[model samples]
Each structure stands twice: as structure tokens, then as C-alpha cells.
Target: MVGSLVNSSLVGCDFSSSPTSRKPIVLAHGARRGDVVALSSIEALPTLAAFGEWLRKPGPWVGGFDFPFGLPRELVEHLGWPLEWQACMAHYAGLSRDEIREIFRAFCDGRPAGGKFAHRAFDRRAGSSPSMKWVNPPVAWMLHAAVPLLLAAGVDLPGLRPGDPARVALEAYPGLLARELIGRRSYKSDDRARQTPDRLIARKDLLARLETGQTRLALRLKLTHPQRDALVDDASGDRIDAVLCLVQAAWAEREGPPGWGLPPDLDPLEGWIVSA
Candidate 1:
């Protein structure tokens, strides 16, 4: 554990490349004290500009961002993008969304039906959507919108890039942790009509497990009554997903930096998710 990071600010962001008021980028801000991570507040950034501004805030903080920091190395190689991390990101950021979709679509067109998308080494372990996937989740666009801001903000991404060590950034996927607590249980839905009682019950059960520190992280979630209720009531699950990321951030902080509990041999072109 890094002594300097004890009780330091921690953030977990559930991001959207194209954010709007209805489905804004949600941030769960908290800190770890001993084995408990206390929820301080939840914030929503309704635009990419707001999210960019938030990234530039002074740090000595660690953030677990729910976005892909890098694309699959296989995809990068196939498209002949820069092999180096920084250069690859620079080239990727230079292209428009349309261009990205066109190129990715062509790439998929060349592959077989079932294995159309190239995956990063950690994708299977984390159970996350492929970073190259531009639809459904649109994580590819999320990567496009986010990595440039992180680069501009000078945050350190362990095992990938080096910058401001105080402002540590790690790729996070809430599904990894959520699956540990509730296997294949759907706890949320964006559509109001689909927010069924069973889903709400699942959310409550998930929260119960988290509060009891039942997951492998073994860190209890400290939430006020209202905070607890808000997580359960948010049918979209964005808020709870952010909190799930917050817990991952806390675990990474406890493990300290450089690897941050990720495998030391992680691909520089496809960063591993923390705690995956």
C-alpha cells in the first residue's frame, strides 16, 4: 500500500461519449478509510466538455474510469495504427467518429461471423464489451472521447503511460465486480417499463452483499440511508455502476500503483481493467 494515498480522494466514473442531461456521465466520489469505502456524493456531467473540465481538476487522486483506455492490439495492428501507446492514441484522437465507424466496420466485414470483433487479452477475464465495439455500448467512442482528455490532463495510467503520478487513472469495468456479487442477474434497465420488481430486488440484494463485504475485494461500502436508496432507485443503474467502480478504485489504491492489481504483463496497446 502507498502510505501517501491513505484517505486520498477517489473517483469512479460511468462515462458516456455523447452525454446529455437524461443520461449524463455519472461520477461517484469517495475515499477509503481502512477496509471501508465511504460514499461522499454522486455528480453528473451532462456533456463531454464538463467531463473534460472535471479531468483537469487537481489531483493527488485516483480515478477508475468506466471506459476503454486502449483498443485491441489486434485491431490496431490490422488497421496499421501506431504500435506505440501514445502515438496510437494521438492517431485515434485525430480521426472523426464517422471515420472510426467506417474503418471498424470494414475490419469486421473481413472477419468471420462469430468472431468479427478482435478482443483484448483481458476482455474475457473482465466480461466487458470489446473496446473495438462501436455499437450497443459504443465503448470505442467512449475510448475516443476519454483517452485524449486523460492524456491532456497528464494523469498516470499504470503499465501504459506515465505522467502525473498523483493523478492516477485506471481502466475499470463495473460488470467484473457486479458479476461477482450477482451472477447473471439483471439489476437495472434504462427503459422505465423494464425496471421490474425482480430487478429492484436484485439491486437490493447486490447492495446487501456489498455492504457485508462479501466480494473478493473484501471492502465494505459505507453509504448513508439516502445514498443507499438512491442507488437502488436509479433504474438506469448508472449511479450504482459508478459506485461499483469506486469500490474498484479503492481496491486499486490499497494495492498501490504501477500495476494497481493488474497483471504486470498487460499489453500496452490494450490496457487491463483494474481488479479484473
Candidate 2:
């Protein structure tokens, strides 16, 4: 079980070359709770080893980390990569960027029928998962970045045993909420100029929905103006990703605390839950 004292936290991370480590910096919202002003830390990484240490300590957190945790097995298998997780990771780690691209390109070529060569879900509607075979969701990358550290730190997933529960991580898809509120019209923005008033209005409306727990997942959360603005200010939607994590954390708290329904032997590196 997680401690009675729970932290409602959201962390938005831009991933780096070292999968398990974080860089390009990490921005944590709600780390201290009580309505936050800005993300806690953001910085470039000098080394993967250092980034690994930082990833685990980013908080007392029930976080929504913005990243994909699973890859389409089709793509992996097609690449003639190892079927097993460990072997696949080793293969991936050893390859250069060009090798990965060439391999991925070949796999995508002459792909299967069924409008599903790449997997991505823009909308959260029923069976909306686009496909799993995407190389970029880099769910494989997500796994490489996360799971090992959690296992070493003694965190457990849904399938784990009691002795193995400490930290908790969930694969949270921010697009879940984005798609829910705005459908598939591209709510993600990186250009400050693109942070148009229309998008801000959309985010405001979305926040209202989250506050009311107005969706299938039944998540109710409170957000201060500062929190709301912080999200709105981030043109890249990173802040909103953290907010999505906040909603997930809120729902998880309602069910139990840190250690509820988590699986054993689940990959910490690869985490997934509702897109929201």
C-alpha cells in the first residue's frame, strides 16, 4: 500500500537519448502541492547515469508522465529484433540512429493492409487506438527509459508481490484528454505563436471537465488559476500533460493509494493506462 499521505503530482518530460534517464530537462507540476506556480526542474543532462538518479527522485508523486510505454509487437518482430524484452533492449541500445531508422523504414515498407501500419490514436473513442506498430511512440523507448530503474528501486507494477512495492509509475497518455475534449484537431502546440486564444479556450473548457469528473474514467480534480495558467502558458502542451497526470493521480487516490492494483513483473520502463 502507498502511504496514507499521498502526493498528487504531474511531471512532463521531454525524453533524451538515454532512455531510462531524463533530460532536455523535466518539468514537475504539483510536486509540492498547494497550487504550484511553475514546473520544478528543467535542465539538460550531461550523462545517462545522472539522469537515472534524477528520474526516480522527481517527487513524492502520483504522476502522469507523458510518454508511450508499449510498442507494436508487429514492428519489433518485423525488424527481426529479439522477441524477448531483454534481447530487444540490448539490440536497440547497440544500434546507431541510422541503423534504427533503416530497420524501421524497412518494416514500414510493404506494411500490412487495414489502414494500420502505424499505431496512434488521436481520439479516445471506442477502439480508437490507431495501431501499436509505431517506432516513434517509441514505447520501446519508453520502456528502455523507465522500467529498469523502477525495478531496481523496488517499485511494483500490477503483477508484483508485496515485498516489491515501493514507488509507482503509470503509462499515462495525455492525448487521451486532448482527444476527448478537442477530438483530433491538433491541440498540441510548440510554437508560441501557435498558442492561439482558441487553444487556450479549449484548454480552459477541458480543465472544467476535469474538475467535474465528467468523463468515462470519472476523474475529479481541483486546479488553481496558477496551475491552470502554467498549463496554458506551455505552448508545447507539456504542462497540460502534467495536468492529465494530475487527473490520473486523483483517480488512483480515490481507488487506493500508491500501491493499488499494480502488477508484479510489469515493466516500469513501459507504463500504460488510459490515454487520459
Candidate 3:
């Protein structure tokens, strides 16, 4: 069921599969008031247990989390994983990280050079990394780490599974919106040495466009001066990415339920990214 957005807090999470004090999971808490999405606070969870604890808390909230929610259907079938969503997730969660990496590596090794990893349908649409990639962004590990927790927390994953209707969760990719605002110009880097002036300018330009409601979502970002500074000053882009996901959550909430602006043809086995 589509829960009442009027009373729901909109959340956007920039998740880290393996979180630490140095690089915690960042969550942006916000709500929509008419055309304006006001960011209220940003917080960090330093461990996966803390992240799970936060998920299990009471909710009349909708969240757009920056993590792959499902594996590619092709990959699952090739690996002979369960076809059923819940069952497949359970099988996946039972595997150790090393096992996962080995299995995925085998699959990739058999594929042609450029088309190494299998991709969910939405991956091409969203321009996201293949969910099976274990390095670089390590989104496969992200899915491995987060999905079970989401399932355990009993949050409603719109297309794939049903649980607490009030605690809705959607896959989000900030790059989708960021690219819309700034094209391909890089706006953030975890390396302090690479946090150049150009990236800082890019962040400001992106924020300016977002503040003016320049994207297709048409939702203005309402932030205090300090909030704006906090978002821009973080070279890692975790805070801004969380806010970007927050914007997507606001869009989904505004769209209301059933699909929540997700396509009617969304694959149940692979899941779709919100606002993709």
C-alpha cells in the first residue's frame, strides 16, 4: 500500500557495505513541504550493525538507499541461485565474501572481454556499475552486505518484496541526478590530493542547479547556509550523495505508490532504481 507521505519523513542514504569511523554510512534526513524538500539533519552509522539497528527502528518513512538491491537475473540463473526473490536473497546472504568473489570471477572469466559482468536491465538505463563488480566501487559487496539487512528489517522494497508499508526502501543512484546537473564533470573524490578546485566548483554548480529546481524532478533543495557548506565541504561527496538520494525519495513519495514512478515493467528479480 502507498503510505501517507504527509506524515512520512523522506530519507536518503549513502551506504558503505563495510563502514568504519573514517568512512561511515551517511544518511540525510529530510521531508517535502510542497515544492521544497528541506534537509533537516545528516547522520552517520559507523558499522553495519548500527545501520541495521537504524533500519529496524520505527518508521513512517521512505528511503532511497544508494546500494544495489538485487543481482542480475542472468547472473543468478547462471550461478544456479534461487529464482524466487526472497529465497535467492537468503542463498546469497549465506555465502561468504570470498565465495561470492570467486563465483563472480568465474562467471566473468567465461564472458567476452568488454562484456565481463552481467547487468540488471536498469543498469544500462541508470548507467550504474554492474552489481557483480567486487572491486572499484564494489557494488556486488554492497548488495551482499545491505540487501539481507533490508530484508531482515522488513522494509517494503517496492517491486521485489513486501513488508512494513510505512518503511519503504528504494534503490537510488545519485549519479543519475548528478550527471543530469553537471554532466560528466567529476564533483568529488575521496583522495584529498585529488579534491581539486574544479571539483569544488562543480559541487557549487550542482548545488546551484538543485537549489533552483532545475532537474526533471522539479523539487527545490532547501538547505540552511551551514547545511550547504557541510554538503559542499565534504570532498568524499557522501553527504551530497545522501542528499541526492533524499531528493529521489522525495520524488518517489510525491509520485505516490504502486510503482512510485518506477516503470510498470520493472523486473521483479532484478529491481529498479528510483528515478532511474
Candidate 4:
């Protein structure tokens, strides 16, 4: 927002609800000096509290975080929840996980077979799961857990909020970039047994494309040899997902606009995904 506010630092977060040492939240921090975007570090926040503190730290950063910032407007309205984003989130925060699941289940039960999940406008474009879905991906819970923290952190969410221009948070989906490089290819798995050679190869190819600037974003990723190995060796793909978001964060910095590549008619209550 100022001449001094050049793109200096960026971050990508692969978040988790109840992160432990085994499945910690991965944070990728990068800095852009000229054209090269260097991954300065990858840190793990083993608890939700730790991640919250990290986000609140002073920054002239544009972070692309891998979490849904809002629920579907359709779901919120149908459930008689608040239409305003802040009020809807406050209402959501008061409910337990079980309560959320039961309410969402009832909404789905009343819908037709193929239309069970109500989607935000950006969901289809970004190839993301419905924001109300509580299981499988549990992105519903991610929103339940993450948005409150974002609000508490008071970072600007572009079209969504005006908290801190110095600390900008954009909703990012790594699958969008990964899918762009390798369609429907599974590159990571939680189960050790499922981490196959082919998936590893896909990760390598994906990273290669990123470094070579194969994306429409026209930004090449710069990672050290150790950083490259760390990204590929982690079979969970959390590290790689964080890097994907880092690239998105860098792109957001370059866009330098009101919405930063989000849809012009983007719903304020249901925020759009960056680079969708």
C-alpha cells in the first residue's frame, strides 16, 4: 500500500486442527529479493496455539494459507445462521464439533443425491471441497478452527477485511497448483504403506515444473538442494503444499490490487481462493 511496501516476505501454511509432533502444521516462509523467491525456512507448529502466535507476529508479508476462510453462503442461510461473516463465525465458534456435524448432516439429508453439499462460488473454480463438509478433508472444521484465529490476528484478508495491510492473508489451495502440473496425480499419503515410488516421482516432476516457471503466475521457485529433498522426502506432502502456497503468496504480492486476482464479484461472506 506504500512505496516502501515492496514484496519482502511471504508465507504458506499447511494448517491442522489438532496438530501433534507426528502431524504438525507446516509453515513455509519465503523472501523475494528481485525475481528469485527463496524459501528461507520451513517450520512446524505442533499446536493450534503455536500457529496462532506465528501468524500474529509483525510482518510486511502476504501469506497464502491452506484453509477455507468462510463457509458457503447457501449453507449458512439454510441453517438460519448469520449472513454476516463475523457473526456467523462467532455463532460457529460457540458450537461443538458434534453439533456442527449433526447440523450439516441434516442439511445434506434434505438435499437431492448429487447436490448434497452446498458450494461457494469459488469451490468449483478452485477444485476445492465444499466448505461445509466436515469429514474426509474436514475443511469445515479447518474453517471453524482457522477463521477465528485469523480474526484474532487481525490481518487484512483483501476484500474480506481491513485489519492490517502489513499482514495479508489469502485463502490458498495447493491442489489447484498441483492439479495444474499433474492432473489427478496422488503425490502424498498419510499412511506410510501408501507412499509409493510413483507418487515420489510425481512430487519430483511437480517441483521441477515449479522451479522452471511452468505456471501462468510466471514466478519460478528457488529452493536449496536440502530444501528440495525435504519437500520430496516428506510423504505427507505438507512441506510441498506449503511451498505451493508460498508461490501463490508471491503471486499475490505482484498482483498488487484490491482483490489480488480474486473474483471481482467475490462474496464477502464466502471468500474466494487465491489463484483459483
Candidate 5:
């Protein structure tokens, strides 16, 4: 906590590429009351259109969104893309997914085994997936799909774009918070059958830690019994991730005047993850 967050609402979103009912985007909504940050509601957006509409809604909110904000500078420069953020994004959006894959694959092919993916500075600090990783997490595609919408929505992304100051958006990674709570413990699995007892226990422990104010962000989380159960019961981890991001948003709201908790030395081209 760096400042008074007496007047802001918080949101955390766990995003998916092709969101369906089975894999909808989870949006966790929360607000601070005294020392406790209470999770008030959750919204599921089943389509990109729905998500776009939700984002454009008026608000004085600080949202922590789980997606890479920019490509690795090395990758961008190597491909001779424009250095300007908006221009680079425009160029990126114009390319087909297959074209992106081919370009990234060629870049990886010449690199060493452990260095196949180029990383942003914030990724190094936060232990985030490489923004260029197209498969596995497919953050590259997520960035491609989400950034344009964010731009269109005109929400302010600190160090990236200037939009509506009231609706502030920050890059957030729930894994960073999860790792702090339980190092290398697997708390989620997309496979239905693999959602085991151990992961459930981990989720419980994480929720406990959050409620007790055990992280760098010094605010306690307040959840109703049903809200706690809902977060634990969903073994896919999207719900918990959204909550984690919501807490991160709360942290950001109090972290600084206008940087959204990002470091002052942050790279303009490579956005910083909130609370990283």
C-alpha cells in the first residue's frame, strides 16, 4: 500500500482467446472498505463482443488484466517493426496469425535451446510467460487479440497509452501472487480429471493467506463463505486468478499517484506488470 485508495473500485480479469460458456472470461470485482478489500461480484464474458462492451462501460476503476501488454523489444526490433507502441500494435494487428507464427518460429529457430523466447524486462522480474510464446499459454495471440480492443476502448494503460484517466488498466499476472503464497505448487489444471485434492488444498491456503494480508500488498481480502467456496470449487483456476488480479488492482490503486504501482524506471515500449 503506497497511497490512500479511498475512492477507487477494482477489477481483475482472467482472459481466454475463444471464450465460450465452458471457458468464459472471469471478471472479479472488488472494493476497499477500511482495511479489507471485499470481492463484491463476478462477471463471465462468453464472447469478445461482450468483453468489449464491458470494458467501455464508464467507471473510475483500476483493473488488473491478465495479458501481456507488449511484445519483447528484441523480437519487435529484429523484425524491423516500428518502435512506437501504437504503430507497432497497428502493424502487428494487420498480420495473420500464421504469419506471426512463422516469424516467431524463425526467430526462435536460430536461438539457443533455453533462450528460444525473447522476454521483456518485467517478465524477467515477475516470472511471467514469454509474450512471444504462441502455444502453451499463447500469450502472443492474447496480446494480439486483447491490445487492439483495449486501444479501441480507450482506457488508460500506464506507460503504454493515454486514454480515459478514470478507467485505468494495468498488466497483471496472478501467477506472481500465487507463487508468493505457494512456491511452484500447482493450484489449477484445465483438464477436468486432473483437478485433484492437492490443488484444492492449495487454493484454500492461498485464500487464507490473502484474507490474512500476507503479501507485499498489505490489504486483507474479505470474501463471503459462498464466494470462498466458489473460488475453491472451480478447479480451472480462472475464478481465483480473477480474484488475484482484483487484489492486484487494489494494490495498484494505493501504490502511486498515476503509475498504477509500476516502477518509475519502467520501459515505455515494454509495459510493467502491476505489483511486479
Candidate 6:
């Protein structure tokens, strides 16, 4: 696979809408080393464009981005959004934040609370994480809006797309991983300034798993002195997302994906990453 250079470790990403957002890029960098990579990181980025530009630039990487690749086929069909990825991106991009929320709300209103919206099968495995949820994370819209941009601009998504699959993209659900470890604790963060001590504690426990490589989905991270402190300091999960992405990069480096880890029934236009 073109993304073979990515590394055995998989980094988890917590994405933002644009550059202006204070949301720091979280990454879970992993490699064979002293290994504190599982802990949350607080990395900096000037802008969303700068971040996107980095994805195409190149390095050993494979990102398990915490976003959706495409909306539910059933949901899109019901809402009557454009059926194709390209057209869907245009349609999603065209909507204002308010308008998008309204449409999502209307869609939610029709369904039961727990059954409010449909989800991908992978999401079922991912559990009740909102980031994985089609409606909550709007990852489907993410796939709709972001993937084309990524493909056109030249990011890698091995076993999924041709050309340089350096920045192999996957719909990672940290919440899926987190829920198993921490359960219903408040892990997601909205404000950089408001990150609480509880988050730091949770990060500490999370780091234990990465250090010992306790879980089946463990990351191998090599953190610099600065990197370690930076990760330790982050109370919110943004910087941690970047660290997660680094771990994902390492995982891709280790694993070989023939089809970006997707099922045969998966949509080609939708794309997916291979899972172990």
C-alpha cells in the first residue's frame, strides 16, 4: 500500500472546523520507545489550511481522524441530499451552520431519542460516541466536505484511494476507545482555558494504557522532552487528538491495508481504513 510508510502506530485526531478555532490538534504518537504517547497532547497549529497543508507534505503518517467519511446512505437518501460524494460536499458546504443545525434538528425530531438518527455499522461497534454518530459528529458531512478536498489536494488514504496515501485517513472514534476505558466521564472539551483537573487525571490514566501497550489498539510513541510536557499540560483533548493522529500514523506504518480497511459492502465513493 502507498501508505505503507505511515508506521505501525496510529495517531488519533480531534478535528476542528477551521483555523480560527482554539481547538488545538490532539495526536496520539506511538513508536517503540519510553512510551508516554498515549497521554493527551496540546499541540499548536496556525490555521486549518496550515494543518491540511501538513497532511499532504509528507512524513510517516496514518491518521484516525475523529470525523465521519460520509453520512448514512439511508439518511442522505431520506433527506434527499445529493447521492454522490462530490455533489454532497457542495451541498453540505453550501449550508450555513445555523441551517445545517436546523436540518439536523428536524431530522432528529422525527426519530426516537436513542434512535434519533441512523449510523454506520462501524459506528455500532464504536458504541454511543457522538463523534462517531452520523448526526452528532456530522462526520458524514465531514466526509462529504473534507474527503474530496483531501483527495484533490493530495492526502493519502491507503487501500482506499490511489496516488500518495501518505496521510491515510480513517474515521477513528476515540470516544469509542475512551468510553471503554473511562465510560461516561466528560472527556470532550470545548474551551482551552477551561480544561479542568479532572481531564488531566483522565489523561494520566489513559497514558498508562499506551505506556504498557495494554489494549489491543495500543500506540507506540516516541515523545520528545518538550512533547511530553506539552502533552501533560493539555487539559482539553484537542492537542491529544494530534497525538492520537501520530499514533495512527505509527499503526499504519505497522499494518498493511489492502483496502484502507473497509468491508466489501462499503461504498467506494465513501472510502474506509482497514481494521485489524
Give residue 171's error in model 2 in angstroms: 0.9
Q: Which ranking of candidates, highest TM-score first?
A: 3, 1, 5, 4, 6, 2
Model 5: how far is 187 from its true place, Å?
0.8
- For model 1, state the Cα shift of residue 30 in Å: 0.7
lDDT of 4 by residue, 1-276 (tens): 323246558899998987899999998999766556789999999989998898799988888999898889999889899898888889998899999999999999999999999999879988999989988899989988898999999988876777888888999999999998888899999999999999999999999999988888888899999999999999999999999999988787777656677768889899888988
* Best candidate according to lDDT: 3
lDDT of 1 by residue, 167-256 (tens): 899999999999999998999999999999999999999999999999999899999999999999998999999999999999998888
lDDT of 6: 0.56
Off by over 4 Å in 3: 1-3
Ranking by lDDT: 3, 1, 5, 4, 6, 2
Query: lDDT of all the models against the reference?
Result: 0.92, 0.50, 0.93, 0.88, 0.89, 0.56
Please say which candidate is ahead in TM-score: 3 or 6: 3
Off by over 4 Å in 5: 1-6
Estimate TM-scores for all models: 0.97, 0.67, 0.98, 0.96, 0.97, 0.74
Q: Give the clashing residue pairs of candidate 1, or none.
A: none
| lDDT score, candidate 3, position 265 | 94
Clashes of 6: 54
Q: After TM-score superposition, what is the CA distance of residue 99 in candidate 1 from its true location, in Å?
A: 1.0
Clash count, predicted structure 2: 18
For model 3, residues 116-230, the per-residue Cα lDDT tens digits are 9999998988899998899999998999999999998999999999889889999999999999999999999999999999999999999999999999999999999999998
Per-residue lDDT of 1-276 in model 5, one digit per residue for the tens? 456334778999999978998899899998976668899999999988888898899888889999999988889899999998889999998998999999999999999999999999878779999999999999999898888889999999889889988788899999999998888899999998999999999999999999999987898999999999999998999999999999988888876557667888987787888899
Which of the two candidates, 1 or 3, achieves a greater lDDT against the reference? 3
